[model samples]
Target: MSPVPPSNGPPPIDAATSPATPTISHPKPNGEGEPADASLPDNYVTYQLSRQTPLPPITWGNWYKELNLLHFAVLGLTPLLGIIGAFTVSLRWETAVWSVIYYFMTAVGITAGYHRLWAHRSYNASKPLQYFLSILGAGAVQGSIRWWARGHRAHHRYTDTDLDPYSAHRGLLWSHIGWMVFKPRRNPGVADISDLSKNEIVRWQHRHYLQLVVLMGYIFPTVVAGLGWGDWKGGYVYAGLLRLFFVHQSTFCVNSLAHYLGDAPFDDKHTPRDHLITALCTVGEGYHNFHHQFPMDYRNAIKWYQYDPTKWTIWVTSKLGLSSHLKVFPDNEVRKGQLTMQLKNLREVQEKLSWPSDNSHLPVISWESYLQQAQSRPLICIAGFIHDVEDFLDQHPGGRHLLTKYIGRDATTAFFGGVYEHSNAAHNLLSMKRVGVLHGGAPHGLEDKAIPPSQRLRIARYNEMSGSGYSSGALSDGDGFMA
Candidate 1:
């Protein structure tokens, strides 16, 4: 749906009438300028449903598309050309070093430059840094910064889903290089990257990409090594073809290996993981798990000991005035994510471990606080206890999407009688998974209390008795076990 033209006041209330509280006004059904309800209380706000524009469906007439002939020619032939040149040519160590240098610079151009600086906006680079990085990135044989950034942003936004240009879930080869050769259907490019297009440098590079690649990517490296060092063939062999192959493979591994290998300290809901091998290979992009969790932060490797050269480069450049506004998340938040995930994973082994349920050590939160956790870390309050149900969301008896709706709010009604009328064993499960005690605010007309010790035993017995026979009326808040 298109946007409704906004007015100065919603549910219009004159400042003279109510100084502190603003009233929300909706369109009158009778086509009048006033609000639909004339009996609204003074100083109160009225909220109506907001309209959201539905996205157009993705159209793919065919299920599969043939691999791009040009991509196959370029990628496939590069290795062949490099192997032939390596055998045919006498490549000097100095010439090979030049290729290594070029490889490092170009990799940075993609990792630190295109990935972090442009794709994630993790830091602010000076105009000169951005300009140079943009040029070096073009020399990497990768697409222009504009194109790269758009696809990358989409990869992060949709990530692991079908819309991802290089969704790792598609398979290692597909995420690494197969995506370039073939796709599902018509490409929609990226969803939102107008900011990338605004830069004149990015615009110019995108427009003259063919020229830039031929010069900086191929010819220039060849000529510089040949003329500067008296061996053009060796330059072409080592610094051109071989270097391009290495850079491409290394960068591609960030998409493939980073998703498949290593550990997910941040979240496992998505495929991205933190692999030290990938980080070292991709110049600090190996911390895929952290990157996915905190994409806004410039550092993929949160710790100093971690091998994140790109993050270090950005930091050093920022100190040197080549970059600024280096974004890093708070240490506490990072710790919280780690602890949350750790506890979540521990639940799998919770049956083996004994849980001490004093409820004194756990966090006490308000209803609003519980709601805020639902934004990412979904939690549910039930029977005077708050449980982190993020891991259980998908495997819910009902449905993941259905359970998501009641997240952050109390599910006591649905569990007891409203909807599913969970069995005795199910109610016992809630007691087993308690993370914290629920504090009833003054508004709820209830006092804060920990779950009674005897109630735990009672539920166990209830579950045992229900094994023989069970009835809906027999369940009274799990036999008055509800605190």
Candidate 2:
């Protein structure tokens, strides 16, 4: 149960020695963009690096050289014990219930205690409650609160970088359990844990972690079953070893499966995601994207329907006077994060689909020029825009003759509702054929009738409406043609 520490690494910035005053700038915890009130304590700690300089790149030495054999051996033995016990030991209903109950206790020790309480300072707990969680966490056999919180803090600060102790970018195995089994050649990025170092309970637990692990992790479970129902063997197998195995793997999935499987609704900049299965496995730590974005928020699954027993436990404890000052990131900021990601996804989809030519790029054609071009090409003016419908003649669902009738004429009224009201799909398709804009708006009177060759007064009206007329000589240049 006493997992070994890394054999070699650089000295971390002593959390106890970090500056007492917060120097790192951040949004006010009130989330209102207002000045901080000195009366209220900050919801989150400002992690500071002892050295201001950027961290050096990790030096990955030979894998075998970095292997933490003792740590690996301890982890490797638990599953074996569970496997052996499963076959040889018969299960008792009492032991099975105890194992399930114990599984939740230890899982909460990591989620509600190690993660939300200490690692992120998402809430405050009473002395007795802290001790209870500390004991339960030790029983989980993950690590001491100080050690576990330190690594988790580093994971958040240097996520996806080499400095991250268990960067998901390294692969699921590396993030889940590989980081524990194999020691890194270089130290993980320094995370300020001055607050953790100052906690009396944390210090006490660290000093007696191994003893607590043995007592609560193994002996206590066996003793409980033995005394309660004379099921000592079943307790040792299911409640002790098998429960530990389940807790270990389920917690590990938060770093591995949670990151890889779900959608990133809050922010896709990080690897964290959200999924129901991951929530069920981790006792409600599955909403990772939101957790990463608003790490100070006490709740992981913010929605009431979401299964976050850990959040529920914290809330219940607060009501019972065991915990208080539960931090929640503002609703406005949470919505902004969700909207930002939605817009980003929409932009990605927009890029994949074809769009019409920009209006700014289309040519301005006088009515005279429109008529000149319509004689040779199937040009039609619709809603002030000139469309070349030569290609669309055969594709027009109504019939080729119907479109041909509008050639060299303004069909704005018909396109709107005169013949048939076009759908969004139809409008989009028509926009693709827009070769130019009519210098003046569509002619209301000229839509149905053709001007006679000798109607000089009507031609003058066309010139007046267009602001300028394009004659044969002006057609080549000095006109709004698509040159």
Candidate 3:
């Protein structure tokens, strides 16, 4: 149906209408040349036009409504009935165990595999992992990965806007689960999954979505039950129906609780937020705020102790050579970004405070100075090292050439021991990593050109070329120490 336009009202008041105006009058001689009498203010003019109110939004049609009714019956009534029947009819113990296992497996598949890996591209996985996750997601009776990813992307893009396919703003019930019950019959432009649709695997899955769901969900459970308990009914009731119920509700929480209640640490433009409770239930997907903030980072919880089982699984799989390219934000960069945000927030809070004396009550200067000092200190130190190295190399021809040999190496220790051993230089070298001098491909001083150990010894000799007879042969090439 077409959308209704809003009603128009009177012209809005503007700056021009602020001042009052005086009345004017004019008079003329009698012969058909009479002027009008004084007139009242122009504000006295009034015009009103009635406009039709827009009709209400269309509710679900009969067919669609029936479909919703059917869904509710299956999801609600069947599960309840099954539970009651299990107790009343004395269902086998094996059935209950199968059901619990299936429920957990399928739930993990959707939350960890489909949503985290495929939809979000949070991490990479091998073919085996992919197939396992895909099959498990299908077992939840949800659509193919392609369809799920497409809808999810749309959800992220539009969020709470009217264009959002399922916005929580549309009402909790509608956004939580009503969308699936009453499917949008109208083609919403073939879904914006052009990339996914192009893939042969995705296309095949999309076409056979229902078949796969039924097979994996119903038939597979039955087969498992038959194999384990020698009864197909055991698997159907336990693994099939029970599993479906749990998985559906858990997955739906991402749509409901994930957006409705959580702490948003990142961009507030979208509804995504982090909810510990939700994350626990969804198997590490609870850090919605952080996930949305850095969607490219495969690990949702940046910290090792963030309680992210999915991340752990990915890590283990990667170690086992099953997954690759697990994207992660560098620690330094993450720390810097977070620090910047913290400073911004602190500044904003200070700005909002109602200060009484000259707006100088806020203790911002000290804190800002500290942060500046911290950020600048390291940079300055590195810069100074580069500068000193360049200058020393330029002044002493042999010194520069020798230093180039150990360029990629940490000459700090060698230099301190050989030249400034009796001085405080040894103390400075204490903290550096204990790799060979030529550890990282000839440190900053040495470029691609390879230099032998002999050349490096020669450079050390030039550096110890003290003019005031401070020392000579203070350097050494292994045995013949020059002192």
| Candidate that scores best on lDDT | 2
Top-TM-score structure, candidate number: 2
Query: Tens digit of lDDT per residue, candidate 3, span 229-280?
Result: 7877657766777668777877887787777777665555678777778877
| Residue 101 lDDT, candidate 3, scale 0-100 | 75
Candidate 2 runs further than 4 Å off: 1-64, 394-397, 440-483
lDDT of each: 0.73, 0.80, 0.57
Model 1's alpha-carbon lDDT is 0.73
| Model 3, CA-based lDDT | 0.57
Query: Model 1: residues >4 Å from true position, as ranges?
Result: 1-65, 186-190, 353-483
List the candidates' TM-scores in order: 0.62, 0.79, 0.56
Q: Which stretches of candidate 3 lie over 4 Å from their true place?
A: 1-81, 87-97, 183-191, 330-354, 359-483
Please give the lDDT score at residue 256 for candidate 1. Answer: 95
Clashing pairs in 2: none
Model 1 per-residue lDDT at 268: 86
